[model samples]
Target: MPRHYVMCPPRHFAVDYAINPWMDPTVPVDPERAMRQWTELRDTYRRLGHQVEEVEPQPGLPDMVFAANSGTVVEGRVLGAKFATRERAAEAEHFRRWFLEHGFQDVTMPQETNEAEGDFAWTGRLLLAGTGFRTDPRAHAEAQEILGVPVISLRLVDPRYYHLDTALFVLSEADDEQPAQIAYYPDAFSPGSQRVLRRLFPDAVLADAADAECFGLNAVSDGRHVILPVEATALAEKVAARGYEPVFVDISELRKAGGGPKCCTMEIRK
Candidate 1:
């Protein structure tokens, strides 16, 4: 069974409501709002037939996002993350307890780079690491060393899109015979990144900015299930048109703090 893992709140990281310069002050940071959105997101996954494992946050690790930054597996492992932000440097320390409590062994940290696992993706074969922002350039080599996976690291050139998952996602076909689809933002892919991807996927689908902002190509999964922001109607339409059911829920509260649905949720077991 597929497992959707999430970290409960109060354990979440939020720039001090007073110091958050990203959003307009007029925008409220009501705890109720965040809870409502997070609850809806959790329920959506549960309703989709996925086993939901809402992990409790560890003490001193105030960031719920720390769960996503670390890599996890349903029956095997739950590796902790090495965060780039000093404020979040202690992010992975709690994993030792969580892993022990959950009975997962092999939960280890990657090499010495200040990088987050959210900065990478496991494509069943190779691991793609995103450079810049939360992950440093040298960290890619470390991922290869620690994860023991063939690693291909690409640099993200835009600040607007902090992670590679923000602009690139993979879609697998329902029919076992159909080839998997890779959707990506052409504008967001720097020349070097583009070259790297081209070498990896010779026929990847290059999506436009409209789709990127719409969240249309930002997420990739089965046609029956897609993960995206509730407000991304254009993206929803495309998914629906492709004969998939889209579960929409408000995560506007998290977006104010620099994350969306994808950033908040990570798949643990497939």
Candidate 2:
């Protein structure tokens, strides 16, 4: 099925500050390489028959390229983001304006601190919300109210997988032809959360530490094609084995700031 996605070019992307475990300011980031990788990802989406929309990248906000944190949109309704850190506080307004200008009438800026899709994964039927890292626990309720979906709270245990998008992703949403599915790293979540996931998605693709560290779970799936990091070879095999085509893209430059394919792409469901 074709999907709509929003992406920001990595024109000014860099790991200037250490916010996540993957970010190392000392490590040099090649802006040109990042742009190449981002463009390839966007082009790949277009090739797959998905609609790709660009958000103008702003200067100084190095992490602005991780557009998935912008907001959560479902059925034409949007729940705007509220970053937990001051470094990314301004990104919320940029994304909010984009939604309004794009003719999204119901855009609500949340009072609670939530990194939007960075910590929220929509499963068609409900929302899987993450906390104990970037997003506040209260934001789960706010998302549930604004998006009008049942929100399941999952607590993150690892700093490396700070955002839910880094640790988990929806593989395919429930439709008349298939059931909702997901892929995730169990160790990234608390024991209870792990149990919840096990019960909810018994057939979910489970990634080992090696694949998770490679940002394997940070993937985007349009029900058929799963776009993921090229470094996650093992996870790609698993994804392919599940009858979904695994498309790889090397976003190593962007990974310097703790983002992968899913982190750079936000699915807009209408």
Best by TM-score: 2
Which sections of candidate 1 miss by over 4 Å?
10-13, 17-27, 58-62, 72-77, 114-117, 173-178, 202-207, 210-223, 240-243
In the range 50-164, model 2's lDDT, one tens digit per residue, is 9999999899899999999989998888999999999999999999999999999999999999999999999989899999999999999999999998999999999999999
Backbone clashes in model 1, listed as residue pairs: 12-64
Error of 2 at 111 (Å): 0.6
TM-score of 1: 0.81
TM values, all candidates:
0.81, 0.98
Note the Cα lDDT for every prediction shown.
Answer: 0.61, 0.93
Alpha-carbon runs more than 4 Å astray in model 2: none
What is candidate 1's lDDT per residue for 195-261, written digit by digit as tens?
8888777766566666565444435354467777766666667656656566676666666665566
